[model samples]
Target chain A: MIKNFIVLLFLFGLGMIFSALLLGYTPDSELNLTGRYYAEHTAQDLGAANIVTAIIVTYRGLDTLGEVTVLFLTAAIVGMLLSTGAGKGKSLQRKLSQSGELLTTGSHLLVPLILLLGAYVFINGHLTPGGGFQGGAIIASAILLILLTDPLYRFSHQLISIVESISGLIFLALGVLGIFFAGGFLDNRILPVGELGSLFSAGAIPIIYSLVGLKVGAEFSSMLVNFSETEDS
Target chain B: MVTIAMLTGFILILMGLYGALTNHNILRMIVSFSVANTGVNIVLVAVGYIHGRTAPILNEAVPAAEAAARIIDPVPQALVLTAIVIGLGITTLMLAYAYKLYEMKGSLDISKFSELKW
Candidate 1:
């Protein structure tokens, strides 16, 4: 009872401290500087209504590219860790086959639609609230659905690895092109900005977002596969 | 209205904290972590909300200048989306590790799985 009382007192004190910190906080003016300018200029200059996408893929495209690399590295590490033990592969396959047909058919019906939606989100990211990350997650969800419905459905390791590597290379090539032809790395002005709110506008933002979407989708799918397969083993 | 959302978010966070603190199972702890993360995400989205505004987008109906004047910030939405994905990835990884540990030790209780201590 004494110990419990002490713990409760400690928690109360911690809560009080956190509340004070929250109450004392003020929004930094400096943080608003870029956000304000970005909001003002994104539509006029980049022709993208989604200021976040403009910031991510145009103003800070390099950072987004780097972020993709971080995801890639994480997938690699997780895959390596999960694949270390693999004795019951055949049994796992059998268990997967027996899971039922409803899941399989439902996932089949949904996967294509999810993929299409993901593509749409990334494609229209410059014009809408959605972007590469949102689109990529949606795409990943499709893959996860497949993994869940069809346990026997094994992703071709070679194909996923090849896709991931090729996307990474393409991402690098685009960045290098930006450095060579544009203002700096990932500058979207390499091609004309076209017109505001047009699909063809934002130069390389859409292309880069599409690439990121693919990479993230593939990586996340592979990670899910790795985790599920490990469980079966 | 915003204050209500903030209060709800805080309540969820507190509940998650209580669960995490009290739970004996590793899986429960992880689930509490997820709840806390979601609560934080809700707070973030709520903070970006403005009255009588829609998402930041330019359509033929709304001119670019007028659209900018009325749109709520999209940065937090994008950031939160990224955060959600990252959180999902981390959660999956944690669950995977937990499963592996369970397989090896035949237990999910946190108190019994302290083998790495020096």
Candidate 2:
């Protein structure tokens, strides 16, 4: 009972500390210097209507690259750990999972539409709030739906791996292209900024976002496949 | 409103931390840690919020010239976006580790794996 009381007291202390911090925090009534600068410059400088996208893809492109690499490494580590235990050459093997006809047909119909929507999301990323990560997750969720509905359905390891590698390579090549053509590595100023808010504007942002979307999708699908094909499960 | 969001985030973090500290099952601990992660993301985004402001996008709703005065911080949002992805990576890695532990010992209770306990 004393121990329980101590835990409660500790928790209450923690909650009070957090509440104090929350109270002390002043929500900005005005745009601060960094915020103001990014807001003013993003559209004119990057030719991207979506300031967030400009900030994410061009201003902080290196961080995004590192983020993608971290995901890639995670996927690789998961695949390695699972592959050794789940047995060799069986990662891509199909299970005997059967589904209702409605689910099967619905998945077949929905898959292409989901892929299209994913493409649309990344393509319009420079003009909209959605971007590569969101679109990639959507596409991966579509794959997940199929995996759930049809457990026997086998995703081609070769195709997914090829897509993943190519996209990463393209992203790196685009960054290198930045060094030769623009301000620095990952710079989006290589091509003409073009008309603002247009589909073809934002230089390599949309293209880079599309590649990121594909790579993220493939990596997620690879991880899901690894989880599904485990030996003990 | 921003304060409310921040408060909610802090509450979530506290709850998640409590659950993680008390949970004996490895899976539950992972779930709790993920909850804590989500709380952190919400707090990060909340910290960047401003009063009477729109998103940092330059569209018809928010004109380009007026954006400096009307938009919230984009840097925090960008940082949070990357943090969210990295959080997922770490969670998945922990899950894989949990799975390996379960497979090795045929137990999910973290207490049972206290081989290094002094």
Candidate 3:
């Protein structure tokens, strides 16, 4: 107990030191507004009401593409690690029978709603706080729920891989198109800039977000399935 | 005030760090890491907070310049959203690995599992 207390104290001290050095420190000038300028100009240029959306889908879209690729690669790695041939030992099979009926039924009922919500979040990401990553995680959670409730419900690996690959290809193609037409990679002005705050506005952001949402959802669901199957094998 | 919130967030992070460092169980460590990550995200969002502000949007009621003037920083919110996604991905991966390790070793204890060591 004494040792634990000492360790806690030491950690507390370290945390305080770090927080003091980092958190409490303010910027050198309050008038410095690089992000503000970018926010204002990019909003008009990209026809997006949300500057962050403009940044994610237009300015730093290459980074977002890379992020989606990372998720895809992660899913693939997890899949490879967990996959085993058929006729594995029975010791790996999950005991789904032990779980309650209510849990299973509730998850079954909630899956569609969760999926809809995820799609909505991605679709309206340009106008809201949520985006592709958030939506994808929500969709992935639905798959996770199904996995927990019904262990025998196997994922169609071929379909998932195809979805992932197709979305990734489309995303890359869109980026290339932006370069060819808009004079830069992932530029949003390729499409006509409709009125601000309109659904048709924010050229390429909503579309990119949708693609990202699909890719992330499929990848994460594949990861979950892969992980669960490894245990079953 | 934002400062107080920041302080509280830091304290939570400290607690999470302690839990992660001292815990013997792999699940506990992962949960603690998540807690710490959440605390950091909270601090980031808090840093973007304005004393008196509204969401960043322009409409018939609110003019564009007025909206921009009163709006709280959207950059941090965007950043936090991305962080949350990445965090979810990493946490899921960790949980998956933990599950795999449990299957192979039949134990959740970290100290006993040392198959890959140089």
Q: What is the TM-score of chain B alone in each candidate?
A: 0.90, 0.97, 0.90
To one decimal, what is the Cα RMSD in angstroms of model 2 from the true structure? Answer: 2.0
Candidates 2 and 3 compared by TM-score, better number: 2
By TM-score rank, best first, the candidates go 2, 1, 3
Superior candidate under DockQ, 1 versus 2: 2
lDDT of 2 by residue, B1-118 (tens): 8987888889889888888877789999999999999998999999898888888777788888888887888888988889988998898899888888888999999889988999
User: Per-candidate TM vs. native?
Assistant: 0.88, 0.95, 0.87
Candidate lDDT (C-alpha), each: 0.75, 0.87, 0.76
TM-score of chain A of each: 0.88, 0.92, 0.86
Docking quality class, candidate 3: acceptable
Backbone clashes, candidate 3: 0
In model 1 chain A, which range of ten residues has the least summed lDDT?
A: A25-34
Ranking by DockQ: 2, 3, 1
What DockQ do the predictions score, one after another?
A: 0.38, 0.76, 0.44
Clashes of each: 0, 0, 0
- Candidate 2 residue-wise lDDT at A84: 77
- Report, to 2 decimal places, the DockQ of model 1: 0.38
True contacts kept of each: 0.23, 0.76, 0.27
How well does model 1 score by local distance difference test? 0.75
Candidate 1 clashing pairs, residues 3+ apart or interchain: none
